[model samples]
Target: MIARLVARTFGLSIAVTVAALVVAYLYGGPAALFVCAILAILEISLSFDNAVMNATVLQRMNAFWQKMFLTVGVLIAVFGMRVLFPLVIVWAVAGLAPAAALDLALNPPAVETADQPSYQTIMVQAHPQIAALGGMFLLLIFLNYAFDEDRRVWGRFVEHWLARLGRVRHAAIIVALAVLLICAQIVDPAHRSSVLTSGVIGILLYLSIQGLTAMFDDDELPDTLDPAVPDPSSTRPAERDRPAHLPVGGKAAFMLFLYLEMLDASFSFDGVIGAFAITSDPILIALGLGFIGAMFVRSITVFLVRAGTLTEYRYLENGAHWAIGALAAVLLVSLKVEVNEVISGLVGVVFIVAAMISSIRANRADARAATQTAAGVSGP
Candidate 1:
């Protein structure tokens, strides 16, 4: 079963890892190889919630779009986000020309020279803006999900009140704006403008995507394929049916693809930066993140969709959204204070593992209830 689901992804991942590590080993010897290995593992673990969050969106897309995600999406994630995005950020933030930025990345200085600080130094300097941009986008997603009236999982008193607050028009936006302002207030004066601008842009981008999705909604557009529906022999009731409102494609498909890519960029904001702590070599970082880490994350997303894992684990999506919320908070807070990436990663893992356990118990309870009902009816 595992082999059938993960064959292609696994095969691709292995090939890439071997090739990348070989390059690393040749370039910088054992140290480089080891660093690459650690980076790949770190990225996969840190991005566990990212995989779950991605699956939620991908499952709503059709087969063709899904392939695009695995192909086009990977390219964008690997090159656009991991490679070029950082260079662009350094150029914009540090006021360097394109060639200069590439030089800074390629042949980083031994020290933070006065004239031109190292690429990693520039990246560290740019963190607040990066955090603000990603934080706002992700925070809106969490707030919208939490405030949704249909949200039935992880119900507590807090959720009840959140749902009540959600009834207000544009509650997510209101909350996000308020949080953004608060983040602006406390962040260093140096980063205030950049953070504010990035945060606002993030909000606008999110709004644009939602508007496009609504505008492009048409029966003529391609309807989303239920990834599980192709198997006629599958007995899982959850996989037997499609969502009541199927997602439409065309312009919306392209928009969703864009949204997914941007979502990945937001997630990678930390991973790319954090890789610097291990090694400052641009080549090694790319080998680990772009080639290996990114590949496996895409593969894991495909596996989750095909396996119907989300449908089976009822609360898994909730946990992932919660993780997104935590990440958003961490990102926003890091504008003022340095927050460890390990802590950020662990928060998501804890939520996901707990949710999985809850799902297992819920499934067992459901089974017992069904059996009891059948037994009671027969006895009568």
Candidate 2:
């Protein structure tokens, strides 16, 4: 039953993605197709780590929440974030007329903007700051995960009080933002909209959105596991008689979905901005990169499920975690300095590749151990 459901859900997603691409193709020509393809790859490359992060939560969710996740979750990603979100950003940052951006998207310029690096070049030139933003965000996330200890550098400072206020659940995120706004006001009132402020806002916004969704969703944490779970592997004579492992409940699954989206948002930040750096057209960005990219992600998700990659390729999970960290670091750096996307991609890919090798090594070790035990038992 579970297998059938997985197949159907994945199939539906593929169909939708294809339909979207077809529409974009009909609306625009080969340029649209090319853009879509590039965006799809970019999105997939950026989101590989995101999927594993999601699975960690999704594996724990029940069927109902799982369905809601793919449905509502896709809508938010495709439309809210992918389409309208960038336009909003451009309006805020470039102070360009949204209508003009819309027109540019509908009728993209003959030449790829990257070929003419006036505005795009300037953005790319800020690569160091971009890398800084991404890098810092990733480091913070990694530290939050890897470290248990939260220390204070200053002795009972006022900022610490604000930081404590920042921990007050969902509301704390807003408080943090307000505090950042106040500081920006005091320190650099003239350039409050600088990259530094943008970075802080982006991080805080990401946190706030994720925290709120989890807090609001009742099924974010399920109460019970599915009855159809398979038995867990056990070797101890007494443990061998233990009951089967329980599957994730609906609520848990929902939470997992939320978690995945949050991670996805974090991973996509640079890619989205980088793409905009490539072409300022919102429509082109959405159609070229948004719809097509979404399709690829859906395909990858299905592939992982069918191939049992998540289970078999367990090291991929570790790789993705590290990738997230790398991406975060890239983001933080991008804020204050400039860095190339290639460098960011390289940092993440290195971590993922290392993790993949580690996973393969661990699997081989497990197999060897099992073989040795079998040989000993048979010999005796």
Candidate 3:
């Protein structure tokens, strides 16, 4: 099973690793290669939660969209978020032209020098705004999952109560807004406006994508169908048989693609900023962290879907969302206090591992009960 899962992404993974090594080698040497390897591992560790969340959504998409996610969607993640986004942030914040921003990224000055700020320094300084936007987006993702009234599966009592509260209209949005407001108060006064604005934009972005998708969603059933009216013969049998309505076609797929990219961007914010701690070279950072990391995430999503891992470990989705919530809180807190990346990664891993263990125990208990019932039916 492990081999089969690896086989699906083996070629792509190998290609990405080779590319990373080559890029690192060209940039520096053997030392650079080792750094690239370390960065790849860090990216993978930090993003396991992202893989689970991606699988939860990717499995709902059609085959074409799934392929698009692995292909076109990955390019956006690698280049758009991991590469261009940072440069753009530096450019905007530092008030430098695009060329100057790129130059600063490619050739960072000495870190110890007090005379001028390095690219890393500038990026670190911009973390508050980045945290605000990414934190709010991620918080909303968690809130939506927790407050989903239709969700029948839950792993905790709090989640069940949250779902019950979900009956209140827009409860998720209300909770997210309250959290954002609280987070804003904790941000530096100098960056307070920027943080709050970015957070509101994050909420708006989520709403816009979701609303647009709903508008284009062809499968949404009417609130009430007249019982007296017969079924429309024009509706295809296959369409009727579909157990769930998924976003399909050009417009809906585009909206879904946008949502996926936004989610990827939110997840990548910490990794992108954190990569500076390892290296200051933008090219090496993109090659090592962006390319390899994005590929592995995509591969994992595909593997989970193919292996039916989500179905097998039912609580895993709940765990991933909880980890997302924790990560969001960490990001928000980091605005006021420095947070260790190791702690962030470990929190997510702990939740996922716990959920997996619980699922395994449940499966075993079910099996044992079934065996006992069968034995009882077969009289001694």
Candidate 4:
């Protein structure tokens, strides 16, 4: 069962590993291979939560859309965000031409030895803006989940209260704005405007995507009621009678794809910045962190869907969202304070593991109660 769950990912993982090694060899020989391997591991460790979150959404999608995520989606993730996005940033910030930006990325100046500013220097300088955008995006994701009053499963009392407060109009947006304002004050004065603007853009991007999804979505309730629990005034249908899942057509599917890409980009922001700490070679970064890590994530997403893990572990989604909240907070705080990547990764793992344990205990308790009820019925 375990082997089948991860079988698809295994093939892609081997392919990505081979590709990374070959690229590493061509770029900087054996030493580069070791670096690539380490970066790949780092990316995977940091992105396990990302995989879970992806699965949460991806499972809702049709098989065609799921395949698109693995194929076309991978290209967007690897080349679009990992490769071209950095060049675009450098181009915009450093006022370098596209070719020059690419050249700088490919042949980054040595931090200690170079006399002039390099790609890494410029990228680091832009960390405040990057962090703000990614943080705000992630913050909204957490807030949306927290504020979902209809959500039946919850991990904390605060979440329940927050959901209750969701009844207020635009409560999530207001809270997000307030947090963004607080974060802006924590950043350097020079970067204050950039941070605020990027954060607002993040919020706008999220709202825009959500609006688009709502507009494009075509699902509607069934016209009839369930016969099992008949009631003349009943306005609701039984859970089993309702559609198993919302059918996503082409437009809605496309919007979901775009949403996934944006989410991946937000997650990648820190990893991309952190990769500089390892090596500033754009090609190597794409091969090791981008290609290999992304494939593994996609594989894991597929595994989760096939294994029905989300359905089995009811609280797992809550755990992922909680991890996202923690990550968002860390990203925002990182604007003012340096945070270790290990700490960030570990925090996410802790939340997910805790939720998993809670789910396990709940399942066991339910089983014991069922056994008792069955025995009582039989004895009588």
lDDT of 3 at 225: 34
Write down the RMSD of all candidates, one decimal each: 4.3, 8.9, 6.0, 4.0
CA error at residue 75 for candidate 2, angstroms: 1.9
Please identify model 1 stretches exceeding 4 Å from their true place. Answer: 218-243
> Each prediction's Cα lDDT score?
0.83, 0.56, 0.82, 0.82
The TM-score of predicted model 2 comes to: 0.66
**Candidate 4 error regions (>4 Å):** 109-115, 219-244
2 versus 4: better TM-score goes to: 4
List, residue by residue over 75-133, the lDDT tens digit for candidate 4.
88988877888888888787888799878777766564434578888888888989999
Number of the top-ranking candidate, with TM-score as the measure = 1
RMSD (CA, Å), candidate 1 to true, equals 4.3
lDDT of 2 by residue, 1-380 (tens): 65775676467656756776686577677777566656666666766566666654454455666556666776677776677655555455456566754554555556756543233433344443344334434544554443211222111343245445545454433443454444344432344456455557456645654566556444433454334322123233332343323445444444456556655555666777778656655665676556656655655554565467766655566566567766765565444345676677677777767767766766787789899999999995
lDDT of 1: 0.83
Which 10-residue span in candidate 3 carries the lowest summed lDDT? 225-234
> How would you encode candidate 1's per-residue C-alpha lDDT over 1-380 as one tens digit per residue?
77766776588888998999999999989998999999998888889899999998887677788889889999989988777887888888889876788887888777677687988888888888889999999998889888876555364566668877889999999999999999999988887998999999989988888778667655345565334432122243443453345654567677778878878888888788788788766788888998999988988897888888997887799899999898888899888888888988899999999889978887888789889999999995
